[model samples]
Target chain A: MTTSTTPRVCRGIGEFRTALAERLAAVPGEASLGLVPTMGALHEGHAHLVRLAREENAVVAVSVFVNPLQFGPDEDLERYPRTLEADLELLARCGADLVFAPAVEQMYPDGEPLVRVTAGPLGAVLDGASRPGHFDGALTVVNKLLNITAPPGPVPFRAYFGEKDAQQLLLVRRMVADFDLPVTVRPVPIVRDADGLALSSRNRYLDAGQRHAALVLPATLRALAAGELDLDAARARIDAEDQVRLDYLVVVDPRTLAPVAPAPGTLALVAAHVGSTRLIDNLAL
Target chain B: MTTSTTPRVCRGIGEFRTALAERLAAVPGEASLGLVPTMGALHEGHAHLVRLAREENAVVAVSVFVNPLQFGPDEDLERYPRTLEADLELLARCGADLVFAPAVEQMYPDGEPLVRVTAGPLGAVLDGASRPGHFDGALTVVNKLLNITAPPGPVPFRAYFGEKDAQQLLLVRRMVADFDLPVTVRPVPIVRDADGLALSSRNRYLDAGQRHAALVLPATLRALAAGELDLDAARARIDAEDQVRLDYLVVVDPRTLAPVAPAPGTLALVAAHVGSTRLIDNLAL
Candidate 1:
């Protein structure tokens, strides 16, 4: 019943990999394991996901890799945050059993991977349509992580996701079902700030004025969810913001993420450039 | 090094899997393992592949599973040969270390699988075009086999195939490269009969007249290899025999299996029905 203060932290992919293998081997049997994959600039949102994983499974493996494949040539991979030491401290405090922080090269040694778990019909719409090859990268990395962490026996592994990335969660669920991978995918509720802005690592890039302007995206989405504004009107409200360069504000089916005419259960997805950083957030309506 | 008189024969997928695990565990850290996937009615062609695998790798594992996915709904699945005893004898003689004979239900308990590996450009033409979803089935089953038989550590598992199944071999090689699976694919030279007929399991279904008629397929292909035969002439030559119901006589690029202008390095493939049984053969020019 005693809590340990000192936390175990692994720096590089090789070191973490060796530790992970030993840890998995130590827990012989009857260990219910869960994985939370993330690009670790740990926030309250990530902690919420970790807490959920801890509550549901006996072991929690959180991977911190800013996957390069998911980033386009113009995207923010180089500038992506790498607070590994802080991330591990947070994970340990949040009751994570292992922190898998693999290097970019370790995850993809042969340059960019070609094995893409493409979303057949769902791919050419919403986030997929906007960011070409984004979901493919997400699914590929998830696939590798799932394979690597999957127990040697027939026991299935459980995975957790935050609802902020709703499209990613749905796509991953679809990929798992399609591939028949015996893994459980659970989605935790989105964590937001007092000002109604969804928590994101890119928030670090926003200056005072740009941060205030970024609030308009979540504000518009909240308005749509509360039925105060129509879809087009809400989109216009966000577009009116001066510092925010709107990429897309779409309403789509929650399952398929395909653009849908206003339905009862739909998702409002927002992507915009506040300053130079491109930030994305979504909410279920 | 004394050879045992009686070689072990695995009856089902579970037994074969258990046996394989035990065998692999016994030989720790030994490299150069090879796999040869086959359906159980072993012929000289299959034995040749096994022998090739034996010569190349320190350990050779052969799987005998008549994958139902590869066969069309109307094609032979039930009627296909299942000579487990004879097949094991052949494997033993060929010096295979382990023989994996899995049942249909063991392989696909949930019925038909959804994860299909398509040949993309190569898959949509020739054999792929003729037999829809055939390569998908072939690739899927091969992927499963490779995953199961892959080395426990960092070393890769090598697989052997016959050039007789030119399209299958090419598609499998494509799958290996595409997935970045830690496996080497080795294609053995095509083994032929004394009369130049490519050996196949379906040859057993041919009656005396039909068997004699089946020879025309290889003969016409050989003739086409020697000289420039127009598509129409090649078709006519393959269809010349009365007993042979010509299925398709396609000259295609060996790599992509797409139809090409009659040229050197192209593959001329023929499939015909001799009586109620269908037979296929291909020759690279």
Candidate 2:
């Protein structure tokens, strides 16, 4: 099959909906749609998700919007990388059929939405505890994206997310189930660089020294996952790294995201600051 | 075109979804779906919504779940009317194709949902202030019902709501826009009894004298709507009723739900207690 060189870009919600409906209608019989939602600073991680979506469905649509609501007042909303040109190139190569890159105003025509999806108790702990209103904002935007991409017919619709954002993945999964959204969540494994640092849009902010120092996050997780370090040992290991300031390194039940005794299926989560950049990573133990 | 009587009833979420999808698939070329969400006392008001849905769409679905989330701690959750046998008879006569009547446990298998849709400031005034977290609960369940009834493919999904619950209808409209839900909200005019009292499931609780007293709500709204009484005058009219106790009588901007001076498009809302049952009514000025 010949692949298209460029994806049809949609800058507005109505345009995106119409484009998807027409595309779905053109298919001869049954058609499946796969969605890869991202705040586009396309790296191997996002491309990996798109590749999976392309392989699994008749049409692949990717959304690239740097959601402002997810970031705190003091957080890096302005400086977050937005490599749209490069993102389209990567998506085209990965066989994406469409890309919805809505502006903030287009997505939220009435400013911040008064009606929103709130992550209840789960949002109160872990990343939520550190970044107040972060998960709520994330869930709200994700909910919108899911509805925005929902198929016009009963055709299969699945959304792809990288397991790198474990808390986000869980909340989104719960949101779909809680709301009965007609979309499937297909989680892609975290993609790491050859140096073991998980790819993040903020990684662009890291200089050489901070980049090297950021490896402490994954390194500690590796030790914990390999049974070479307990929670205390992992905390001590990250603390010894002079350039990396340890935030929280705790073992949590993967299902509930609550701190739990380290067990086989529990997840080890770590967050820290390499220079001024905040980074997080996790591993299934 | 022939219509089926005795609408099919679905008691589980999965069952309702599949039933709707298959029904849509059977339609010749294009199909349309309309949903009427109610708490099942099958009053004339609900019948009005279902009749509108039947007239407008190829398939009409009515949800009859008595949502527990929408009721407050001291509210009439336990005593709220549940007349499924009669509800089905009314829906069949109204040409509804399906009825989703899931039990509380069927709807909330995981107990209380941690994540939910919240109506911010719009939910805080009028009825929301009197029943704290009421709109939040209402929006949460309504959001779920919208998702549950969302067409598999975009085949013109519309939800019918009675304007009797003015706050709720407005919030649902906002939620659809905020979440970019795939459904359109169609508001049917308030369905009042011959005596002018708005039909509500809770109306079943009012005894003979109390039912007559409840007419004060509609009387005040009618006066305000007809320009015979201003906000203060309407409040006084209800306040002077010996059997009716006034809760709040005010004029609010239709768009923002915030208090505003009476204008051409302003809405006058009244909430009062006749005996132990509370009733609310609204009229556009």
Candidate 3:
């Protein structure tokens, strides 16, 4: 997924550090630095985060790293998309001043880290139950990015994430508080296409029929949120949908991600397979 | 183990943050901030760290929290030692600028953190093996202290630690590097008494005879370093002592804390029981 586009790519840690330092220096006083972490293949969803950063920060750095730690051995570790060039173009349009796209070796010099940040019970449910060790990987790399991009002068360094990764956002919030990290984590609303399908890099994997079937994801979510579908009714919609296999569709406590009594203002989450690609979607009542 | 002495004690995270903010502001531009983390029961060894911090930084903060996370249920979590009054007097004599003494709840607002920083395989041997979850607890709270005390303006913050806890020091160093923290972790030389026994809070648990028996620790360290004692010979030295029980004495790779080929510039660690109290000591060969 390597693109031919460009936007000040920082291939190494030293370059990224230098670029970040120089950028912060150019801001003179009390600069608000914002970070948007992405795995390349940037779409409107990622741009939305960069745009919020651009609106709120004097300096914005978008990390286009395809973190290997977050990908499992059986998952799409190798084939996960990498559209650096196109991502750069999108970020530039969104006013991202710097792009940190380090090589795998640059981010992990000694290979797998000797120490790791683990997500306990909260991470073992929902999507975590489907993909074991996924949240651990996400937390480890996200923590690293938060640290590596930690502002030099404590002028308020914030990291922006999308609500599509609701669990990841919550975990990041917890990790920052638990570690007492000096960074603000902001979550952007989930972005979707005109077709109502939630935007995802994996959305590229869906065939025409699979793409149409994926629409049921948001449809079911909207129905559940609008009271048109109860827990059983949503499960029925997912089951009745063709060309897609439902993994799980249950409402959970947004804070701990635990299954609880369904009610308004709670979260309804779904995970399913459209052909060979897995998809997840969620909404708040 | 509650201490009766107080020196501007910060009871909660908000107070600690505000106190630290005020002290750091008092120093203004380019102020060097130093931190000394201790589990109370401070000795001259702890004072040595404060002295170095006092000399190196314009602002020095000492955290005195007896972290329950690092204490095993069966171990001395209940009686590790807390001499807050004496500890504060020592810090005052050392010219500490601020003392952050947070309660257990302050550090952990949500009970035990579900998200934990794990020490991986490095924490599985020696003291870690003897006391399961010890290193994990050490790493977790140490990381929290690091985050809680992170400089507001990056005026060159450095944390002072003693080398007496060689493994703890190494692990702290590892955690700092692993997390890319914004502060420098400074290691002070191991402070020892005239008798050569390393100073420790747990030394209070020793009786006169047990204290005398504890000298075998430093003696064997010196012997091993001088090439006068082999592994078996060192075991024999401890076996010959009375009122003291040898637990485990092995030379280890200072980097990984695993037993390795003994050599100079590497660590030789030992843990033994002086009466009912357990103690650990290490030295670089």
Candidate 4:
């Protein structure tokens, strides 16, 4: 019924929505609602977002659902971890006031949504290219979440997204703008572990040797973005590593995600398979 | 200032949104807001929908913008009528509380929206097949309109749509259901003329002779639906007419728009070019 830190835990949309409605009703038209959406393998990165929301808002809600729409048939949809019990405990410590942990049937009651919101050219490259039709699915759930949590009147609804998934963040920001959605997306800084590798749920898949190999990704991105190492050098360094198989290491325009001509204001993003664990990380140039 | 009907007229989104916000605030937590979207060529059919909205809700907002998204590139975007003064007067008589008559630039400030709501297989047949990418545009604007008029929380937002544009009505309904949008789509019965022809803005393009030829369309649809005439006989009768070239005449599943095998529960729709003007009409089987 409750998390350790006074957070109301709601299993159904109706339950959470009513809880949200009562919270919004207390402060009519005041934009104090903040939403942080996640696929529940909550780590320090998700905690950081929730903490930011707690500081910025009176009522903060965290949604935990592993969106099945965003995964390709061959991808790790089934393999994706479900750690709600742990996620709730983490969210409580991070100060999330409420959690919407709906069943898959609740989020998608009528099966696959026929009407879908698509990210155009921006979604077609980088992350979107390898996983075909991924952003469209991600966006469908994101749109629904935004709508589901959207305030009744002109009440401010601030949504927090992690820049760790850089392309996903960009697409979400654009979706909010294009659709004139009521919520403003606030990008939280990407949280990193002490060793400099970006913390990710997929990192759980890496063995001891693979974990050591995964450090090369952020290191390569950092060197490339800092102008200390050229892309060729970065690629060569990543290739020399034993376990990691390089997927793509490209410098792109931060907003468009198009491969740029190595300018100062670019983002160096890398994705690779560190012994069967596919991981992505980006660094601002 | 005011239309003949004394409704507040808002020319820009900024103005309309603020006005709408204030209007919705005065009656907080009550689902009294109703929206009827149109392209500003207000005929009796549009007025009928607006009248229904006025009767159903405490506050009714009618939007009159000729959406460029729904118009095909080579289609009659330029030739579309702009009768704001006349439209306002009609809205006033229909008991609309306010009108959002935004300019094209206001509606699409960023030019073409990169993010769009797409209608899938349901949008691919009948009128959709004839005008590729048409319903997507329709759904996008409809989605925008719904969001703009969406109540901050869940106080009830009902959208009125005419059944005359049968495919459009179905697609909007599906889009609402598919996205789990909060608004309810209330379809009004088709408003017809004395001689059984569907009321349309493009009907003005019909000359005396074209008007007479246009009667054959509705007549054919009616006879086919009544089972008094078979598809072949209806096509022959329509083809035997003057100055009218039938584009398509098919009986389809009303929900999916897939072509049906002359079943009872179907929709018989017809499109024809009477002179330089294109027109469409449908009847329930």
Most DockQ-accurate candidate: 2
Cα error, residue B31 of model 1, in Å, equals 18
lDDT by residue (B141-165, candidate 3, tens digit) is 9888888877754478899889887
- Candidate 1 structure quality by residue, lDDT tens digits, B127-156: 677688777778778877776666543444
User: Candidate 1 residues A77-139, lDDT tens each?
Assistant: 899888987887788778887777767677776566533344455655566666786776777
Q: Which residue window of length 10 is worst by lDDT in model 1 chain B?
A: B1-10
Q: Which stretches of model 4 miss by more than 4 angstroms?
A: A1-3, A26-31, B1-4, B26-31, B262-264
lDDT by residue (A1-285, candidate 4, tens digit) is 123575788888778889898876776546488999999999999989998988888789999999999999989999999998898789888878888988989987878877888888888887788889999999889998988888666567899999989999999988887787888899998899999989898889888899998899988887786788888999999999999899899988887787886777888888888887889999888
* Per-prediction TM-score, chain B alone: 0.91, 0.97, 0.94, 0.95
Order of quality (DockQ):
2, 4, 3, 1
For model 3 chain B, the run of ten residues with the poorest summed lDDT: B1-10
Lowest summed-lDDT stretch of 10 residues in model 4 chain A? A1-10
DockQ of 1: 0.15
In what order do the candidates fall by TM-score, top score first?
A: 2, 4, 3, 1
Whole-model Cα lDDT per candidate? 0.75, 0.89, 0.84, 0.85
Worst 10-residue lDDT window, candidate 2 chain B: B1-10
Q: What would the DockQ be for model 2?
A: 0.77
What docking grade applies to model 2? medium
* Model 3 spans > 4 angstroms off: A1-7, B1-8, B25-30, B152-154
Candidate 1, residue A238: Cα displacement in angstroms equals 1.8
Question: Can you give the lDDT of residue A113 in candidate 3?
Answer: 75
Per-prediction interface RMSD in Å: 4.6, 1.2, 1.8, 1.3
- Residue B71 error for model 1, in Å? 9.0
